[model samples]
Target: MAESTTQRTAGSAPKVQLSCEMCRQRKVKCDKLSPCTNCQRLGAVCIPVERARLPRGRFRKSKAAHRVPESDSADATDELKGRMERLEGLICTLMQDNGAAANTIVPAMADAGILPSPCNTESRSDLPWPVGNDVRDGGGLVAQKPSAYLGNSFWEGLMHVQNRPLRNLTDQRHDGATFAPYDILVHGLTGRALLSPLCSTTEPWATPQLQQHLCHVFLSQVDPVFKILHQPSLRAFLIEGKPYLHYDAHRPAPEALRCAVYYTAACSITEDQWPPAIGASRASIIARYQRETEAALVRAEFVTSDDLTVLQAFVLSLIGARSQDRSRRAWTMLSMAVRVAQALSLHVPDPPFLITAFEQEMRRRLWGAIGLLDVQASLDRASEPMILRSWLELHAPLNVSDDDIPFGHEIVPAESDSFTDSTFTLMISKAQCAVRSLTEPGSQYMHIRQACVADFQQTASQLLRNCQPDAVPFHWYTLQVADYIAASMQLIALRPLQRTPDFTPPHVSGSNLLRLSVDILQKTETLHSDPRGHPWRWFEGIFVPWHALAVAIAELCGCEDAALIERYWDTVEGAFERFGGLVADEKEGMLWKPMERLMGRARAKRDTLRVVFTPESASAQSQSPFLPVMTPDQNQHQRGMGLAITPCSSTSGSIGVEPWANVPTVWDEVDFGDVGIDQLSWTNYQDFMEDMQR
Candidate 1:
């Protein structure tokens, strides 16, 4: 028994040591096990160190006078000076190189007509707010105030003037106050003018039952995409009528956010799903909720407010507004929200001592949402993205559900690898980063364009892998949307290639670009037509793929392959028939007239081709899953009209199946420049389209 006990004691010895010797030298926390994390990261062999016995005495304070020798301090100072000198020299060398490069590039750009000449003499208007090096008076103002206006989407004065010594609007103001007469009216005296006269309470549209339903819808459908609000906290606040850390009477951020949620939910509700007890049509409900949201925004003083909740409300309201109207007004409002986010420093993470991990994650999510919205707005109008890549240091939020984050706790749960509440938001952030280069002027270069495509594909594949095949409806829908976004961004990145003269075999490039466009259009068509996509149709309706439709129609006008031509026409006309309402619309002004012309050309091409498909082949083609389904009457009408209805024998993927190098050149008869495609090069397609309309 004594021998057995001795053997058991020897076998029960602890496996862990004090720490690896390297970690001990570096003074980093480490797991005491062999091959510690720090050693592994540094690729060093971990040497285990046993714990040393310490003397049972207090730590002694070192004498300040004897801490260092005078000669050693002098040596340290000399080394520091040498390092500073080297840094200064390197900075000067870089500046000189950059200046020389700019000097060489600018004149070349001017010669190439890429930059405006000095003698162009175009009047450039400055902002109403003062911006200069000397706005201070003789009295010498103590400090400069920050301007609320950050600038247009293309650039911001704040970013420009941050490093420079400059006086802002504060120097001109009487008491260094940033508020103007308009701000006084909007923020102080005229609150009643904008107050909701429809309902006496804060949310008249939100009865308890209705609020529950809307909250459910928003949480399930919209929250997955936005991921701005914390579900548990939001629900608690709603139930208890309590305010968060930044909430106040003057800044009604929570109320505004609530109204915004109600508006978004109402907008997202399908006609069949509308509550009968509301005693109003879904349209009327959306309008009333929208008005309430606007009133709430005014009450919250959103323009001057730097509250996170206010920004969330503003973003949500803009999203709801997009469903109602695809106008520049929403884009302008979105830019204002971007400015507010910048003011709040949402582009950077907060220190651990300053905020809880939960709040930090929330802020990251809000910034991600803003970037996603900016990307959407840019795509909608073909304008420069509001949130530039240079300004963002924010990372995507963790892929965990709200339940994983405990309220008022320091613990941060591990992020899930599979689909979660934040998966869609993370995907959007990735997509935004992928396409950000598209807004840069340098993206016209072949290397940058190719890099953009490569980066986007890599990110997209990673995202798709994270999503499960048989996940929930929204997750599956997000997958399809990912495919759509991938196609759209690739099209944008490759669009500049068509204008380049050095690209060999223009026909192949044109064909590849056309296939990308077709893929985008088909994706759009599928999202709108599918029954599962009905919940997300509000968003789908807003982002109509106008550029893709144009490309497809342009290709079809010259395409000789009967089957491919018909497939192209089927995609184009399906888009047109569904979104034809926009053709007559003056609000969300797209280039419908140019589209009409392209369709005409396609019809003319159809008239020239003989319709010679046998009934048996037609039946087989009709049974093909790739082809668009049409009713008997519709087919008869199209046949009578001599439309190009040929059977497709080729069985390949619907989305750009042919290899890039092997795509036959069919762009011989296409004249994109004549149809205002050239004008789309430097400006928003809609802006050019509007000019053409005028």
Candidate 2:
């Protein structure tokens, strides 16, 4: 019987042993030992198991959940592609048509069966949210429709300007057409001849070579102060004709942006510095590019366009305009730029959409530039700043080089401690906070001045020391701008003291107010007269230091020190010599008359001080303290003569001497500690007031 049982057991399947619960759960092999190999390897406790397992067979069927069909998704994608292709085709067709007005034809075709219709309620289900209402129309990309078009008197107003016939665009000509000036047009209808005498087939106004030169000029001279455009990316685009394809990419900067760069470059340089190969006068080039820039902004519908690049272009145009002169037209344009920036939500530090690191840094830089410009424009108009008081969360851009920001998805590098292209702009950004305090109701000047000094003085020194040799001129310009900012803030702060009934003038020996005023005037003269700073002198018109000049003349009228008066007078005369003709024709040109009268009063003060301090005043004047002045060698190799004295001037006394030689060049530690004004002692206070009234 035992032999028969053994034979049956052998014939049947061998006995199966169960694995431990740990190994069973892990689906790993296990020996029948107490601590299995899998559990020992994992350092887990092996629980002995004797649970029954389900019988192996075909698995039970489970109910399926609802999902979108692949076919439907494919169809939608295909439909979207078809719509895009059709849109491109329509654009090409319109471009080919000679007489077709894009404004009139786009809506007509959209109404007909030719183009894809606007996404309405029924079609909204197929389109994505937020982008469903966004479509290209005649007046550029239409703004998103408000959830409710609320209006006064319970009347529903139009939410979008799309397909609407507006009478005038901001930069449009008197005529209703958005057309480029004849000077900016290069090719002919037949493509065989040029339309304008200045236009050339190889290198016209907007040719790549001219653009390259101007762009280099801008990058070297003006961009360091602003630092908005990415240097490497822009240079690459100029060379390879492909911009960085990423969020908010300009794609070879649109016409408005391109022309803005050109206009600004022309404004920065003098006529002599203009490329001789281009064969165009600087004035003519500036006028043509300026008109074309305005026309391009009109065509882009800058007021309503949502493209960040369009806003950038408009801001740049306004910057150039304000640089040339702070006219009411420029202020009006600045208001438009403010509105556009607000519409783009640039005030918000963090946006709802995903953006690359490079784009984030760029947006911050742009906002910084916009805010700074707005404050400056306000200062020029004597109005409150538009953005400094706002609840903006945007921060200053990092002081990093353009190359530090990666184009790919790699992590962004840390901001550098050394000076970079963005250092000056970052300084401006931080200093603007102090500028905001100047306009507040009960703000303290000392606190603000100290804040600026503590924030910028050391950094400015470090940056100047760290700057590249080739970029010294731009850094010097930045240093001068810093000095001007501090002096101007003090000027703004002290103006009210002049009006107060309890005003007190500083001691006759020396006044920080006078010193600061002289500092401002000296910087202004340097910005306009220095050959190194010629490429950035466009700012001279906007920041003319009229207030500082007035204050310096007033303080000099009460001065007792002959040398101090002479030195201060030298600064005033230098300013007049450099900027007299430019500001003479400006709207504030009437200021020159009172300023000249004040100059006369200051000369009288100088005569009195000379009588008191030293005899033989007339002979001593020739042998002045700052004398033994060296006139520039007439035969020396000279660079472009940009607002500098003519080399062949017959009046040979200190003819070619730098105006700022006696003035303090380093702007590191300016003492704005005791800035005040003297109402009773200021001889031409009434004259200053009269000129202001005029």
Candidate 3:
């Protein structure tokens, strides 16, 4: 029986199943979670399945669910039809408005039209309307639709005038030989050109009559060329396709517009010719000239696309002529010149000339009003301080020659020297004073202040080391260094005082100590490797002695930022390790002998100890009060013991000791006021001390 049942099951066809719409479309197994996989993927609400009830009769199948009502089905079909009809109408309206043909509209609607045909095409054309179309023809397309043009006819007409010649004007009538007053008047009225002659160069020219005649020709003929070129419609047609329209067509090309402005200005000057007649002719010419000039000025001001150099030069000449006038007009002209110069500096290709011109004009105006001091003040306000600082830093090396040694009287003479030197010094002093003044406390400019501080610090340190003591006093150099230090301190203090606790500090940290240490470390490394002997190192003994002094001071002062101090220490320690051997032997008790004696010392019979010291004898004359002395034996012993016990004590406190206890002090007993002990005595003393200590 089991074999027979197996055979029957095997013979039966496999059962096929249909999935829920959600599950089948989603291609996921329908675990039938509250929403099936398909329903979840589709974001559709799933309906739960109900169990089917069995019929009472043997093996009777359950009936299927009932269908929708006939009337409801018919109504649904009718509603769908109505919506489709509305959509078709919308598409037709959009197509018509976009200037699509009726046939095109049908195809679009049949395919996938998104919008109805447009109701009006007047506002949609990218090209100008045909020239002959009537405005009143509502059904017919207008030939010259306003929508087709990007700009008004003014720009287009101007461009045409520039490109085309005047119909009846003769060469002689507007030539360079004789004045054509009538021609000049006509052209000026017609906006062809100004009434002045245009000269290409500043060299001497012909007589006034000839100049006037040339001016008339240029005004009557050449000036119109530029006007036509500036026309919006024409320029637009040239740049964009004939089918494309630009709203700013009248706007001039950057180069061409600039040239046109300059030329127009060139035509306005009344060089050798008499002024325009004072009746209607003059008034009309003046009004037209003013309008064109104003337009050109506006163009120069806002249109960054063009080079304004030539135009600026022309404007500058006009301002120069009227600068002495008492009227506001003169002031206006000067102001315009200033603005043009500034703009040209930024946008024009050749900035040097513009910068020179601006500097000259500004000096002229300022000197006339308030002298050099006020002019300097104005310059301070006008330019970025860093630019000036950078200029000085870059040019300083070039200014100093081999002949200009800091200490020598030849380079830096006494007050009684030649007037030229005095004048030079005075100028430099004045410039420095001006820069410093702008950087003083409460000044609105913080960048200038920072730059000034950095510059002063560098200069003061250099002068202190390289210059002779008699050349510039120690107090003066110290004062400058003190100023920088004070400024640095202020910068740090201001951060905490001026801002809320939540505010972050600016990029320039308040840790002057950290910056100073870093600077010293970098400078030391540079000096050690420098072939020429780092020039700044000449004053190491006079200025801050230890490269690590700044860091040490910072630490002593209880500066909150420890990381900066640690970084500085690391850099200094690294440098010490690298170059320490060159100066002294850390393992031995011997001091560094001069380089000349290195071979002799190496060949010496005894094992010698080396110590690194700055050598007080080399700082200045032996009698100099600033010279440093070797530590006395008793003091050295006490300091070594104290350091071993309390490493931190040396940084904070003093250890009292006598002069002759554990180590020999080389110069302790020598009376060197008149003539210090000989080098042999000092060396013998050191050697004896080392042997005794051992």
Candidate 4:
């Protein structure tokens, strides 16, 4: 195909004119080349926007001039081959210069079937992420239905536009000349890429002996916190080996299970527990295991399959999430697990025929556990529970042991009711009820919040009533700790009722809240002081009691009542000492930053009021106030949320511009001390509504 001789002679031969579309859109002058000046300056695509200027009445006088001469018509075909070659050469150069841009353009060339184009022809093959697909029918490693693409006319028009560059000095089109094509095609096509391979990096699979050992340790140590998996099935699966594999396309991958086991096991290990000759300490080893677990999950193709292992892995992943600083990622991952369980209708009883009674029971247990997690996550992050409150049909797990059901058994009938899970569900329902009723309250929430005190305590007491001497150590530990957790949760749930603007003299005022917090803390302290209490220091998330302690100390320091402050000061001091002591041995600042800051504030309080202590009280403590902790800083870069106040001087971590940040927010004096954050964030409030609606 030849360019029209008249058109070329009128524009290119004499003097170029007209600005490119890109320049016009950008409101700039264009050099008007195929790859024009403004596009070059901006590294953008340039296509000419045809001007509709007909030269006014110039057309009437130029009717003869518009006609092509015989010489130009005859010679038009002579330059056709040369022009075609030049155009082809320019295209090839652009393609090479912008190989990545070819990916965006390539989709237009071939169909989705042609993904990971044969033309990726680069020497490198190992890409960290997947490349886009190319045209193909159904036969391929992974099928792509198709892709949306701009037409060939659009591409051709963009790459090569009419209207030559104006050469006139006064013409704005004659400005600059350069062009660059930058492609974010990878990001655009990222949706189609399977991320499983990216999650492929994993630790070596553990030996059978190690796997068994870890499984035993995990069951004994971690299962009580989130009992999502069936112990009997897990034990048989680990011990009986080949019998456990699912005969289906979506069988649970061992790698994901391995991750779940290893991650749980990480919680139990300590520096002293690690074997000698291991250069790294316990924390490093645990972190390595966590990374491996994530990698294995990615490789397991968890998202595409309805595998039970993946759901359990997500639960374990959530346990690990609390260690992360203010991360919401776990909430998102937990939502996926909730969705998967709901999809399988674990919320309802398992269907009659497709699965055995054992599997049916297992599903029920997992579903209930998932609910507990969903509720907690929602409460912690101040998000609505993912499980639609009204649709929940989930029931309690059977109160039986793994030993109750031997391998190859269809199902084990419950001999007695297990209050552990059943009561847990009831209390969770109550807690959820407390949460929902509190959100943007009505008169009804008042009655409900008032009842939380008795309801939470009664339910908590019942939940712990099933323990026997012969029961597993971890099981007993979980029940005991749960009693404490429920007490703390009650305090959290009732906190909002302390501040009802519409109602006078709320159920729990600042004084009562302080008393309740101290009560919970004292109970936690007692349970913690017992022989098994050593593990309380190591427990993560809900079991940690940071909220209870934070409120207690804040109230203790800010309290106006001399009697309350005097009476609770020692407990507040003791709690602070315990937390501070825990973090003091670390090479790093602390395991959790919020704890560190809380401890710091506590010390500041003691220091600020050291003189107020009586001689008798002073004799029981150090004569001088605790020295103010100076946050070390090279440039004082340490910064994040959670701390209500911190040292000023953005460049300095120690000392402050003001005595306090915004003003000392005293507990009980402020709404936080009254209602707590859960009520404010609408998490605990949602739970209240869920409970009542139930």
Candidate 5:
């Protein structure tokens, strides 16, 4: 017993190791592997103890068994994504709120358009953001400013404005080149307007016939495509006086909306477009209507009153000038509307209790139109779309003509067929909103793969197939024209990336791209304001991209395949003829002038293209007087695309010169001209490179 006790004492020593079950059972020497050598030798079943599986009387960690439910995991992931998107949007708002004074790192960063959809979004987290919607906390900016917040989206946006300049603070040129677009973009976002002297008008706003003419001009001419100002109700207000034309302490008849209509109509043509009863020079009439509108805005407090009519009036006024080179002002004008729209929660879907479905529909129309304006105003930019889809729960306006939906028509009791019929119209608007992300020509928003591109193409085709041009020519054509432009731009994007829209790792076939380009050009037919008469309107939309067309055509004209060139040759000539038609619209005044000037440049470019893209061109190019200009490095980082070589007007620089200087403008050098490397055709690419070598 004394000997056994001594052995137990020795066994209980500090260095004692646990024995394997097989060894312990066999009472033999064993190593601590799962199957001890002794078990293998005995050919017995060996069960090794696992400390991890062993039950502990004490000192075990209190972790619950981790069998995560699929639903729970999915919910967590979705919640996290929602938080991230919200945080991103908040940061974007703060960037705008912080303004030039706060983000001294790059003060003049362009607030290039971003925003939310059809009235209101049920899910704010899913909303796509436009880069420009900076109208300071829902237009209460007059009362307060956006608080500063920092994040990837905000700083990334600021850091990546197309052709933005960055340099040592010590550099003199940096201030001029880098911040030029920034100053312009943020100018209107600041709470207070500088208050300009109100210009006066001479048009007869009280004249019933004149109001009739102007309203007709908007609906017949503009509304089919734009659809901003509600047509049926607006018409009823004029003809039947149903909605009560309410205005504040001003010349009762000369309210903001009326002035806007007058201005837009007057600007739409020279004095000849109107009858003798509405006699006024186009220039003088434009001045008068503009004056009345501005004066009314100054006195008519839309913000304090929270009247959407005033906001609508204000938007209409801006729309009158939408065709102008107001890229800078566009940022402010639309952003102001956005703030008010948000203040009214127009981006959120309305409950039937809060607003009738009709009202909700109208609000959605206004918001969607505003979102489009916000994008177009940014000079046809795809990055930082102003409105997000998630922020709006507003459905698309019914596809039915205005005649179908009377004033205050309720949706709940409506025929389901009418609602179902309007699917195409809704689809078109979705495409328009998606343009900001879809038309991205650079790597800035490339995560959007080919599937999105395919959907856009399919939708465009479907819209075209279902549209009745005779029923609503302007509206139908508007959708048609926009789709064609998107197709053209997509073709451009597909070219340089070589692979499909999905960014698959392969080069796109040049021939498929060529065929697509020719097809887009063929669809780009010109239409006049009157089908067979005077007052010719260019087939222009906010998204009507003349430059992209020009680039695509230039590439096509230079194609190596003789058969393809001959096939699409007339299409190219036709595009030019149509573009040249704008010059005849000299009577349209300043609104048409920017495009007119672009056409003039296109004419010059045409001479170059004829030589470069046609069969009889190589020798001509050798003798060409217009030499290509080259930058030391043709790039600056536009956000996620870090220092990529942008061939669009050479967005790069050398020493002492402002790194961002001489970057083209919408009115000047190039308007939103980043079409990716795809815009550069192989021939043009080679030629441009050769020039660089020279």
Candidate 6:
């Protein structure tokens, strides 16, 4: 029965052994599955007892059936449930701790490119870290813990904890909160490509966004061409789109053009790499010339004589430089002297004698530089016959006739040949020479005086014979000739009075001279008094002739007849006062003051005469050299030879007035012999002669 029972027991028992749950948890082997299938069905771990030495003759029962009693089963089950619950809670706490540690390690790992995008499981838990076991113990679960961070978790943890403060520090460092979003986007994109794993995905070919960004960067780098062209207008148009197309066209504004030219010239001097030797040499030469010229002007201020040869030489040098290649740089420097001369002529502060000489010098330099023949070309281009006539009237006294004078070259026959026009060319050239000579000192005055007389006679004869009495245009020309005649007569009168006071009078009578003087005075009064007269119509044209007449009449007042002299004086005073008022009306500020001074001088002279002499004060007049008509022997010769009975000389005292005293006058008082009329005329004649010789 025992044997049968053993067989049943062995047949009923399970064949395979099972491990205890503790040894199996640790992966060790076990003898049997104590409480294995049954415990498993009950949701309990199977545990086996250790093998023990058996007592002699005693049978051992499996301790597995000695499980808790039925009454204590509930208690044991409760206790097992509590222990399992506690163990599970401990494992969860450990898992939470491990996940937090991983979170700290992952960022640096990703930065180093050692961790994958989504980290593997082994990478998460391999702390102290086995290769591919990246899980750290302190922080939260992190998928991609960088290999770099895993090397030092303590440092990584501090860095992770310090993120907000570091961010604050970065914001303070860059002051980046003030930056615009576009700026931030640009910086962030750039940094990500430099620092992140995404760099590997970046394409070599330019994308649309990349192209746009590159273009913006390139445009920011270069200066705008239009901005360079219109520098002054840059600020006004910078923000305007399509500035080049929409802005005003660059027509150089006058101020901008002037400034540009000046600046360009200045920059050329400054920036050009001129040879040091040449630049220094040129600068020194310029400085010396300036110093010398200034010194010359200073010397000229105190000089009493009218010789302008030094100044002329300086001016000629300047003009000669103009046609030369090297002299371009001297143009501005030369203009300075020319301007000074122009100013001096316009404002004549020098004595009349000196002023006359300076004006002649100015004309000489101006005409000489522009070739002599060019003056004729200028006159030939005149559009109006009246203009030609007026020009001749003002200038012809200094000119001579073509037949009497030598012209350097004759006009070719192929061109239009008018005798009058050819005569006009000769006239202009002669006039220019005459003006030049007049300005130079130590020039002979006799020939100029004679040429002036001859010119006056020729002009007067032509007008009186050819001009119709009613021809208004021709009248002014006749009047100008008459003025020249009067001026010539006055000069002739002054010559004998100055050098040879005791000389016998000429055959010409003072009465005839008086008649000529009265005629001119009456004509001038009639022409000026009538506003419709040609002289009044073209006032500027008549100013020079009128002034000459005034001077001539003033000299004429020194005649023999008291009544006529008084009449001449009154006439001049009235004419000058009227002219002075007209000058004021014209607002010709430059001429008005000089005209005023002349009028004032005339007034003072007239007032002095009124207070000194009565209406019948002729007898009180002194016996002067002008009183003797002819010496006794000269009178007898005229009577005996059946010669024409010469009229009483101005020296004769025939009208019961002593010869008019030849008072030292303005004309003779100033010794312009160094710069006189005759000398000027001879110089001009010589120049003409030289040109003929050439």
How large is the C-alpha RMSD of every model relative to the true structure? 25.4, 23.5, 31.2, 17.0, 23.6, 44.9
**Pairs clashing in candidate 1?**
none
Model 4 poorest 10 in a row by lDDT? 640-649
lDDT of 5 at 485: 47
- Candidate order (TM-score): 1, 2, 4, 5, 6, 3
TM-score for each predicted model, relative to the true structure: 0.60, 0.59, 0.18, 0.54, 0.50, 0.26
TM-score of 6: 0.26
- Flag the better candidate by TM-score, 2 or 6: 2
Model 6 C-alpha lDDT per residue in residues 1-694, reported as the tens digit of each score = 6445333443354454445656555454544656655455657666664422322221224323333334356655665554444333322222333455445645465456544323343343322111122321110112333333234443453344334221233244335345343223322322211111111112221122322322232122111100012222222222231232132332112212222222121112211222343323333323322322322232233122123332332333232222121212333334344444334342233324433332332343332333232221221211111112222233222222223222222331232222221222233334434333322232234545445544544534443332322334323333333443334344343232112213222222233333333334444444443433422222221222232333334344333344445545555555555554333123243334444444454456556666655656644443231232234544533221111111121222121221112211122223333433333222322332232223
Cα lDDT, all candidates: 0.58, 0.56, 0.31, 0.47, 0.46, 0.32
lDDT of 2 by residue, 276-347 (tens): 887667777676667656655655667678887778777777777666653466766676678878787778
Q: Which stretches of candidate 4 lie over 4 Å from their true place?
A: 1-209, 245-252, 277-281, 323-326, 349-355, 388-394, 405-412, 418-444, 469-479, 497-512, 525-543, 561-567, 570-613, 616-694
Which should have the higher TM-score, number 1 or number 2? 1
lDDT accuracy of residue 314 in candidate 2: 74
Q: Better model by lDDT, 4 or 5?
A: 4
Residue lDDT tens for model 4, 1-694: 2324324443344333577767765667677787886677778877765433332253433535675644455555545543444443333333433455645666554355433334543422322222223221110112133224433433453345323332333243345553321112211211122221211112222234444555676665566445666565666665555434453322336556656676666566444445454444556556555655554565565555577667667567666544432345555567677777776777766443477656666676677667666666655533466665443343555655555644445755664445443343444454554444444345334355446445554554554455441234433344444444444545555444223445332333335456556655565565555444344334433434545666665454444444335556676667655654332122233233444454465456666666465666534433222111113431131121011121121212221222122111112223422433323223333333233223
State the displacement of the C-alpha of residue 586, model 6, in Å, after optimal TM-score superposition.
8.2
Q: Which regions of candidate 2 fall more than 4 Å away from where they truly are?
A: 1-204, 244-253, 389-394, 408-412, 444-454, 458-472, 483-512, 560-564, 581-694
Best by TM-score: 1
Tens-place lDDT digits, model 3, residues 457-548: 44433332322222332222222223333333333222211212232222321333234334344444433333232222222211121213
- Which candidate would rank higher by lDDT, 2 or 3? 2
